[model samples]
Target chain A: MKKVQDSSIAGERSVTGEFEILNQYGIHARPAALFVKTASKFSCEILVEKEDTIVSGKSIMGLLTLEGSKGSTLKITARGTDAEEALEALRTLMENKFYED
Target chain B: MNLKKALTKDTISLDIKSSSKEEVIEEMIDILVSAGKIKDRKSALNVVIEREKKMSTGMQNGIAIPHGKTDTVETLVAALGVKSEGIDFDSIDGKPSTIFIMTISPANRTGPHIQFLAEISRLLNDPATRQKVLTAQSKEEVVDTLQL
Candidate 1:
C-alpha cells in the first residue's frame, strides 16, 4: 500500500505505487494475464517496473519479461484521468496475490 | 534461462493442422512428447487442459501460450506451433491466435518455468519477430527467427 501521487503537469495526474509479488510462483503467465486484465479495464496507462526493466502493464509478454519472482517488488505507475482508480485496483490485485498461492 | 535447451527444431512445427484451442494444445503437446521432452502424454495434456479450463492462455496479438506443470517432465520443455490460417483461442483481444507456445515443467520448481516463459515472451513481443515466426517456412526458420 505504499504509493505517491505526482501532479507535475497542469491537469495530468500520475500515481506511482510499489507492491511486492506475494504469489508463490511470482508473476508467471497466469498472474501476468490477471494483472493485464485488471489494468486493461481502465482508460489510464499502466507501467510496471522491476529493477531497471519497465514494461506495459497491459502486456502479458512484457510483464513476463519483468521476471518478478516471489518476494520481488514492482513499481506500478498509472497516468491519466483514472490513474488513481487504476492504481487502487492494481494494488488490490497484488494484495490478493492475484488470487493464487 | 536457456530457452534453446527446452525448445529444439524437432519441437517447432511451422504448420499446425488443428483448428480449435483444445486440438492445437494437443498437437503442441504431441510435438513435445515426440521430441522426448514429455514422457507421459496423457498427464501433460490433462494438466494443460485443466489449467485452460480455469483460464485461457490465449494472449493478445494472435498469440496463445498453453502451459502447465507436471512431474512427468524432469525440466522445462516447450514447443512452438504456428497455424497460418488462425484459430479462435478466446484471446483477451478477441482475435484469432496464429502462434502457439506450450510449455510443461516440473511441479516442484518455479524458476525454470518462469524464466523460460520470460525469455520466450520477450522474444515474441516484437512485431517483427512475430511476423518472422508466423511466416517462417520451416522448423529451422522458426528456430532461427526465435534465435533458439
Candidate 2:
C-alpha cells in the first residue's frame, strides 16, 4: 500500500502517486495490459513515469517502453475530474503486484 | 533491440491466411518454427494460448501482440504477420486486428523479452509505420518498415 498525493489547481484535479514494483517479473505484458485496462475505465489523462521516461498510462506499448523491472519505482499522474479515482485504482493494482507473483 | 536483426524473411509474413484468433496465433508460431526459432511448438503455442485466455493481447488500433514465456525456447523468438482482411481478435477497441506480432521468450529471463516488446511497440505506435506494415507487398518490405 502507498500514499497518493492529491492536488487541484484552477478547478482541475490532479493526483500523483508513487508505487514500487513488487512482482517477480515486474511490469511485463500482462501487468502493463491490466494497468491500461484499468486506466481506460476513467476519462482522466493518465501518465506513467519510470525513472525519467513518461508515457500514457492508457497505452500498453508506451508502458512497455518504460522497462519497469522488479523493485523499480513508477510515478503515475492522473489529471481530470476522475483523477483521484483513477490513481486509487492504479495504486491498488500496483500494490497488489498487478495480481501476479 | 534491433528487430531487423532478429527477423528474417522467414519470420515475416506479408499475407496471413488465418482468419480466426487462435488460427492466426498458431500461424505466427508456425512462422517462428519455420525460422528455426522455436523448438517445442506445442509448449510455445500453449503458453501463448493460456496468456491470451487471461486477457486478450488484441490491443487497440487493429494490432495484436500475442506473447508468452516458456522454457521451450532458449532465447527470445518473434514473428510478424499481416492479415489484409483483418481477423476478429477480440481487440480492446472491438476492431478486427490486421497486424499480428507474436513472441515467445525464455521463462527465466525478462530483459531481452521486454526489450524486444518495447522495440516492436515503438514501431507499431506510428500510424504511418502501421499503414506501411499493413500494405507491405513483400517480406523484405515489411522488414524494412520494422527496422529500428
Candidate 3:
C-alpha cells in the first residue's frame, strides 16, 4: 500500500491500500454508515474504487455498492482543493483499522 | 437548522442488539415510530431495506450510518444507537461496530441530511472523539460527544 504524500497534483491524487473490513458480516449497515460519515469529513472529492466500480465517497449509496467485504483491498483516490488532507485522513481511518477492537 | 427540532431525548438508544442489518433497520424504524418521527414503521423500514439491497452503508470505522429518505417523514429525525458488544455489520474495516447512527428524513430535506452526515463523519474521524464515543456509557454522553 503506497501513501501518496503530494496531493497537490493537477489531476486527481490517488492512494491505494489494502483495508481489511474487520467487521464479521463485512460492510453491512452500521459500518456503511460509519464509512459514509468518515468520508464526509474532507473537502476533497473522494472516490473508492473496487474492482471496476468507482463510488463517490460522500454518497451512502455509492459506498454501499462497493460491497466491501472483510479483508478487501480498496483503492481510494481524492481530488480537488483538499485532496491531500482527505487522503491522509482516509488513510488514518483505514490504518487505525476503523477503530475496531 | 434547528438541531433541537431534529432530535429529541426520546429518539436515542444507548444499547441495541440485532443480528443482521435488516434487524437493525427494523429497530431504528421502531425507534422512529415511538418517537413520532415516522408514521408507518413497516413501510419506513422497507424503504431503508430496499436502499440497502442496492448497497451496504458500512463506511470504515466501527460506525454505521444507515439512512433513508422517504416521503413518510415530516422532517429530518435521527436515532443514535450503540452496541458495546459489537455486532457483525460487515464494515469496510472488517470489524463489528459498536456505534450506529441512523438517519431518517423526508425526501425534501436533503440539505440537513447532508449536513448532519458531514458533522457525524468529521467528528467520528477524530480519534479522540471516536474513543470517547466507544467508552461512553449513556445516551446523553454519546450525544454530547457527537454534538461537540
Candidate 4:
C-alpha cells in the first residue's frame, strides 16, 4: 500500500489529497473561516468530502455541516486551471491544523 | 459559474491607472458594465462597499479580491485590474495590491461562487503566472497569461 496520501493521478486536471483531522476541536469557527477564506482565494473548484458525503471546499457553512470530529479523515479534491495549487493549499492547512491547536 | 465562462476578454485590463481602493473597484466595475455583466452599477458598487465594511477582501502577496453578491446581476461576472505599481489595499499582509479581481454574483446562487473565488486565488498563487499578469503589456496578454 502506498502510505503517501498526497499523490495525483495523471491526465486529469483534478488532484487529490487526504489528511486526518488532528486539531482538538476539528474545524470550527476561526479554523473553518480561515479554511474558507484560504479556499476562496483560489480559482479552482475544491471539494472536501468525508465518508461518502461531499461538500464544496469554499463554503464555510457547507464545511461546518460535516461536523468533522478530531479523527475524521478528509478526502480533498480540486479541479480546474489551478487544481494543483488548491490541493497544496488545503494540504498545508490541514497538515498544520490550520495553525491552531 | 466557471471563471472562464464569465470572464470575457473585454473584462480584463492590464493597467488599472488608479491607486485608491474605491477608485480601483470602480474601474473594475466599469469593465463588467461594458461587457453587459452589470445591470445596476450603483447598486453593485454599494454591495461591494458594504462587504468591505464587513471585512477586507485584500489577500497578501499583492492581491485584492473585491466581490459583491447581489441582484445587480443575475449571474457571476468577473473583472481584473492589474496595477504594476501596486495600490495600498489595507491587506492582511500589508502588501500593496497589484491584482484586483472584481467578482459580482447573484446572492441567491450557491456553490460555484466560492469555487470562483478559490480559482482566482489559485491563479495568483503561482508566482510565474502572477508575474506574467503583472508584466503583460496589453489586456490580451493578461488574458492569455490567466488562461495559462
Candidate 5:
C-alpha cells in the first residue's frame, strides 16, 4: 500500500523542526504578515510545511493558503546562511503564540 | 477595532464613483468623512495615500484592503465599497479589484486594528460570505455580511 509522508528533511544547510500553532485564531493575515516580515529579514530561504504541503515562508499569500487553524502542526525549514537563526526565530514565534491574546 | 461598530450602513457603499486607483481611494475615504468617522479629510487621505505608496494594498481575488494608522480617527473605522466594473488596484494577481475595504485605525491602538484586518481576511476567505457581500445590493446587506 502507498503511504504519504507527514514530514521530511534533507541537505546539510537545511534545518527543520516541528511546532504547533497555539494562537486562538491561528495564522491569519496579520500574523502571517508578521511571519513573512520576520522570515524576509534573514538571508536563508525558508519554507513551512503542513503535513505534505510546502509553502514559501516569505510569502504572505502562501502562508494564508495553509488555513492553519489552532492546534495545527507546522514543520519549518530553512537553508543558506543564518539558516539556524531564521528557523529558531520562527519556532520561537509559534512558541510565543504570535503574541496574540 | 470592533467590526460590528466599525462597519455600518453609513460606511458601506455600492456606487464607488472613481476609475483610477488613487481616485478610488479618495472616494472611499470620503465615505468615512461624510459618515463623521474622519474629522480631518485631508490628513486622513494623506495617511492612507502614504501607506499605499509603500505598497499597493491590492490583495488578490478581487479584494483590496487599504489601511493606515493615524491619530485622526478615534478608534478603528472601516468602509467597504464595491466597484461593479472593477479598478486597477495594482494587485499581485494582475487582476482588477472590485472590493475595497478602507480601514483607518488609530496609531496607539494598533493591536486591535491588526486583529480586525485578520478578521476581514477570514470573512473574505469564505465562499458564501464573499459571494453575499460582493452581490449585496443594499448597504444593510453589506453590514449584515460583515457581522461576526
Candidate 6:
C-alpha cells in the first residue's frame, strides 16, 4: 500500500474510499464481523457511510444495520491519530475483497 | 453477555436442507421453537425475514449469518447450522455458503448483539478456526469447535 501525506492540514490526515461490495451475498454477519475486526485494529475511528446513514466501523451491528447488499456502494472514511494508516489498512482489506476466506 | 444461558444445544441444527433464504430461516425458527427459545415461530421468522428483505445476510466467503432483533425473543439466542451442499445466498463475495450462523435478540438488547458479532467475527477470521469448522464431521464437532 502506498502512503500519501496529507496536504490539507499541518498534521491532520484522512483516507477515504468508495468500495463496492462485490461478494454475491452482501455484507452478512460473518463479513460484517470480518470488516469490524479489521477496522478495530487501527487507532483511527472508522466510519462506514451507506446512503444517508453513517455508522461506527468497529461495531458489527452498526455495519449490519446498513444492510449493504451486493453491488451496494459504501463510502469508508477513517480519521484520527493514524488516519492515513487506518485508511490504508482498510483499503487493502477492501481491495482484497474483504479478505474473504 | 451470557451466551451460555442464551445458547441451547437444542437450538442448533445439523445437516439441514434449504434451497432458499425463507427455508433456511424457517428451519432456524423451527429450532428456536422446539428449543423453547421463541413462542411464535411465525413472528420470529417474520422478524428475520424482514431483516433479510432489507439486505441479505450472506457475507464474504462461504458463510452466512442471518440475524434479527424482535420482541418475540425473550433473550439473545443463536442457532448454528451447516449445509454441506451449499446454498445460493446473495453473498457479497459471490460464493455459495456452507455454514449459517443465525442470531436473535430482544429488541432492546443491543450490547449482546454487538458483542456476539465481534466474537463470531474474530472466530471466523482465524484460519485455523475456519479450517476446524469446515472439517468438522458432525454437529458436535462444529459446536465444540465454536466453543462459544
Of the candidates numbered 1 and 5, which has the greater lDDT value? 1
Q: Go through the candidates in order and give each one's DockQ.
A: 0.89, 0.67, 0.09, 0.06, 0.12, 0.09
Question: Which model is ahead, 2 or 3, in terms of lDDT?
Answer: 2
Residues A1-101 of candidate 1: C-alpha lDDT, one tens digit per residue: 47676764778888899998888889988898899999999998899999999999999999999989988999999988999999999999999989987
All models: lDDT?
0.89, 0.87, 0.68, 0.76, 0.78, 0.73
lDDT of 5 by residue, B57-129 (tens): 7766687888788998788999999997889998755679988888898877665555566567657766687
How do the residues A2-89 of candidate 3 rate in per-residue lDDT, one tens digit apiece?
Answer: 5454534556554444455554435534455566667777776778878887777775545655666667767777777666677777
lDDT of 1 at A39: 98
**For candidate 4, what is the lDDT?**
0.76
Q: What class would a CAPRI assessor give candidate 1's docking?
A: high
lDDT, candidate 6, B37-135, per-residue tens: 788777778888888876677775577888888878777888877776778888655678777888888987566675666566656655577677777
True lDDT of residue A11, candidate 4: 53
Residue pairs with backbone overlap in model 4: A41-B121, A42-B118, A42-B119, A42-B120, A42-B121, A42-B122, A43-B118, A43-B119, A43-B120, A44-B119
lDDT over C-alpha atoms for residue B78 of model 1: 87
- How much is B124 displaced in model 6, in angstroms? 1.5
Q: Which is the better candidate, 1 or 3, if ranked by DockQ? A: 1
Point out where model 6 deviates above 4 Å.
Answer: A1-101
Q: Which ten residues in a row have the lowest lDDT in candidate 3 chain A?
A: A23-32
Top candidate (TM-score): 1
TM-score of each: 0.97, 0.93, 0.60, 0.63, 0.67, 0.63
Query: How well is each residue in A41-79 modelled by candidate 5, as lDDT tens digits?
Result: 899889888968788888665676676778888888888
lDDT of 4 by residue, A1-101 (tens): 00234444565477777788877667543455578778888898889888786877875545655667677888888877788887778778877888865
Arrange candidates by lDDT, descending. 1, 2, 5, 4, 6, 3
Residue A94 local lDDT, model 4: 78
- In the predicted model 1, the residue pairs found to clash are none
